[model samples]
Target: MTVTDTEVSGRRYTVHNPATGAEIGTVPDCGPDDARAAVDAAAAALPGWAGRTAYERSAVLHRAHGLMLERAGDLARLMTIEQGKPLRAARNEVGYAADFLSWYAEEAKRVYGTLIPSPRSDQRLLALRQPVGVVAAITPWNYPISMITRKVAPAVAAGCTIVLKPAEQTPLCAIEVFRILHDAGLPAGVATLLTTSDPAPVGDVLLDDHRVRKLTFTGSTEIGRALAARAAATMKRVSLELGGHAPFVVFDDADPKHAAKGAALVKFLNAGQACICPNRIYVQRGILEPFLETLVARVAGMRVGDGLADGVAVGPLIDEAALAKMERQVADARAKGAEVLLGGARATGDDLAAGHFFQPTVLTGITRDMDIYHEETFGPIAPVIPFDTEAEVVELANDTRYGLASYVYTRDLDRAVRVAEQLQFGIVGVNDINPTAAAAPFGGVKDSGLGREGGPAGIEEYLDTKLVGISVAR
Candidate 1:
């Protein structure tokens, strides 16, 4: 059964499994009217939701988290079917998503106000946080459940009502999430979900509507910029987690095999569909050859098939468009003289012919002229480039307009610290590939996107700070 009975806009659209081109289910092809309704619902519910105490807000989120854990197995299977990640990865995503809700549940009670000493003895000063009102959250297809939870959890925790628009490609997982929230006692209209194929019209309505006080998005940088421009007219607050061309660097002191292994594991996560996946690899010249060899070998051994199939480490790309993009990127690199040291093309046998499957690929002899050198390769291909020194690698890494996240593998404490500091990205991983945690802030600087998500700061994104001053003796 479908998760919702809400009025759908326009026609019904069928969602397909990228791995087998099989029809999974249909969702309402929502449009602007549906978007408006969701916004209206949130606006109507805002006062009551925002008026609730932090403890009350936290209690609902905690219930949702518990419900999520109780349904983890079902949600994970559904996620794997629609989103096309390995079943194990899907299970982990569900758990991580639940953690976000649970973490924000606790954080709600900790949104402390500040008191300040006044310059005048008889005056008083105070700073307090209040909900930013209605929030419009747009999430991507890559990490469906977590992206939604990451944005929704904090907004609700901050006493804000939300209207969520999940990517059309993966609405089932999101629908399930909202169902859990509803079951957890989230008041109707406090949280609403809209599944739509065309988001521009919907986004336009949300951005133009004065009722939406804040907007949070996880998608391409291009879309993020467009949304930001639209939000500008309304002067609404926005938090964007956009595209990333993350760098994975290995210094001479690091173990080439270990660095390569870590890099390989991270690059292949979600079939390299994640925004923070490493797009480029920079290895010190002294260890370049060994690193490349190990990376190629590691990638060579990974299994590529349906996400639900046993032992399948990599799954299909989201759709044919993604597969074509990967094809073009690899073709562009090959034409520019980058050697295809490992799997470099789409998988073909009867077992994989119907699927949007690309083999886990590794390319070396990369140069600045190659497209993969700068563009975000949202596929299972790792482009290995060599650097002569720390200064050169740092310069090369920071040259891109994106500053989302970067990784550095080095045992030298001073070098690691220096490089980490020098890197322009918002989050840096030293000797580790995964830098994310529920307690740490994530987001980027420069063109990668703006504002922050996760951590204590995440709640702030959904809140407005107000200062009060009183003349006690005037």
Candidate 2:
């Protein structure tokens, strides 16, 4: 069973498990008409949803969060089948996804209006927050459930209807989320989920439709820009969490072993598929060797196999294209003389042969000329670069156009604060690898895209501020 009995957009398409090269299931191959229908449904439902009191909407989101927790194991298994993260990671993600619903459920009631003192007697000034009408959300394959929940939860919690187009590769997991929402008493048409192999037509309709007042996207920067451009025609509110080439910086004062362990753990989380994962690790020249050695040994001991397998710390890449991309990046680095200190080739075993597996890899002597240093390596490969001074490391880290998440490791309070302030990235983790939470804002500056997600600001992305002024009639 899936989210709805809504008729397919002409046909259905197969969804495969990247871990096994096997078909898990099929979903509706939604297209333009489906997109239009979803938007129309959302627009129609917006008034009723928006008219509801904050408490009323909060009730539904709270119910959904509870249901998510109850069905977590099932959802996690489904995620592993389609999205291919380790089962443990999938379970954790399920909780994280539910956290958004819980967070926004409370945030709903906290959407307070402001009353301002009028300049003249008998005059009144007020600021109000209201739902931004219909929302069109597009989420990526990586972190499918949380991405959807973050967008959908806030929009619904803010009393807005939504039309979600989850990535084709991981639509099944999204279906389960939609089903949970529906069962949680979300009114029909208040939330529409369109699973599709072809997104161009759907995205086109969503962007072109005037009914969609807001567009929230979590995917590639290229696609986000294109969508934002088209959405401009309708003056749609846009929020984008795009591609990241996050740099993990370690200063000389930092514990080399601790920093390396942190690097290995974070760099391999989700098999390095996360947008926040470090693309480049910069270590102070004094501690570079120890960091590299610890990083190499730890990553070398890590296990890689099917996400469902016992003790498998890492899982397969999403598909052959991802594997090929990792191969090319590593090849480019090797050709440029970077040392491959650990596994640098595709993992091959009878159990892993059919999967899109890449061995956890580590490379040192990374230079600006290497592709891994420049491009975001969305795989289990860690590239280490050495730096001498804070100014030099900060410059090297901020060299990329992307300014999403970045990390810095140092025991010195002044250095931690200084480097974090100097680094031109959003959501810097000073001595902490995972700084994201339901209460803190997550976004980027520069080409990393615009607007913010999570925290109190997340719901604001789905809200519009209105001002009211009254003049004396006497």
Candidate 3:
């Protein structure tokens, strides 16, 4: 796993195993030269890659999907080692990532364009969707495999070449994915991968490169805003899936046990580092107490240990900064009088102290003013707030600047649909906690991000429209 680059700087850094906090491998510290080379590689491959028949592109992606499946276990283990997610969760993420590639493979041939009717009988108007050209894809550390797949699959499906800069902390997973694609017969320059410790410099290089026609990113809102502003200089097409403070609303009509389980599933996934993870839980006043109790019991039963361990339910946070941020958020919430229902203390055992570990926390009596209630606490922390009426709760849920994803738990089908329709989010799950799917469109309505990342809408993000009108002699 030692990656060497003679062209770039001779500096090398080690990638750590989060579970053991041990050095697993070393990667080159890529610089602007590497970034420019990646962009140049993508630019060189664009014409041929884009000119390939849709069927050829689909076949290549199918090969990549097969390779991903063949290496699923290895890739999952790498994800666990670097990202600190439970092995099972990492495996599931790899599977989900493969699904995106397979889905977009089929979608490649289905990028259909419509024909508009013309007033003149002899005139025919045809509109076609074409590739936007070379794409610069920047992925986040959380859900590393799937996030890369979400951006790369669609861009490739739309017949665009890509220069991908994966987060340094979780670069191995993307590297493995790129290796799989390379083994599956992708041209060298069609999909180039680069790893860098410095994101700002690498991002600037990508943004300033005129050959880069589109920029697709998944990260913080601050970074996304800066990238958007820079990309605007060239008027490059941009697709961003940014930060979120998603609310999980449990209505009084919902089954307490079911809602608790669902909430725990969403809140604890990836140590609650996912952008769409439920940061706030708004339970109806009637079922608030029972819901909190059940949720606490569920969280208490979870086993926290190394991700490589078979029965571990939760693992360490990605890094020290993330752990510190979560701790500050918890302290702020407690100072504001929010009740710590169950596990609010960080683990301090000799084995756990070295790595970034936080107890899955549940907070009650949270008001609108509390930082935990309104802000995105990107950790295994859930603040349970009570709401009296549906109108009040929905308003509170939509109050945040982020409109990425939301959850509603209720047996009342009518109420579920009603609440879902009113919630100003891009994706809503009624009973299920998982809102992401290969078949559905996924994106945010507001600051969470612009443009969609799944289904037909995702493909459209990498494509441009062209209209051709022909006049025939009558």
Q: lDDT of each prediction vs. the true structure? A: 0.91, 0.90, 0.87
lDDT of 3 by residue, 304-407 (tens): 87898888898998888888888888888889888888778776687787788989988887877787876788889988888899899899999999999999
Q: Model 1, stretches more than 4 Å misplaced?
A: 1-4, 8-10
RMSD of 1: 1.6
Error of 1 at 443 (Å): 0.8
Q: Candidate 3 deviates by what RMSD?
A: 1.8
lDDT-wise, the better of 2 and 3 is 2
What is the clash count for each candidate, in the order shown? 0, 0, 0
lDDT of 2 by residue, 1-474 (tens): 222356545689999999899988877888787778788788888888899999999999999999999999999999998989999999999999999999999999999899999878989999999999999999999998999998998899888999999998998888889999989999989999988888898788888888889999998888889888999999999999999999999999999999999998999999999999999999989998888889988998889998898998999999999999999999999999988888899999999989999999998877789888878788999988888989998999999999999999999999888888998998799889889987789899877889998999999898888999989786
Write one digit per residue (lDDT tens) for candidate 1, span 1-474.
111356556567889999998999998877887878888788888899888998998999999999999999999999999989999999999999999999999999999889999889998999988899999999999999999999999999999999888999999999999999989888888888888777788788899999899989999999999999999999999999999999999999999999999999999999999988999999999999888888888888899999999999999999999999899989999999988988889998897988899999998888898888889889999988888988999999998999998999999999989999999999999998888988889999998898999999889899889999988976
Q: What is the lDDT of candidate 2?
A: 0.90
The residue ranges of model 3 lying beyond 4 angstroms of the native Cα positions read 1-7
lDDT of 1: 0.91
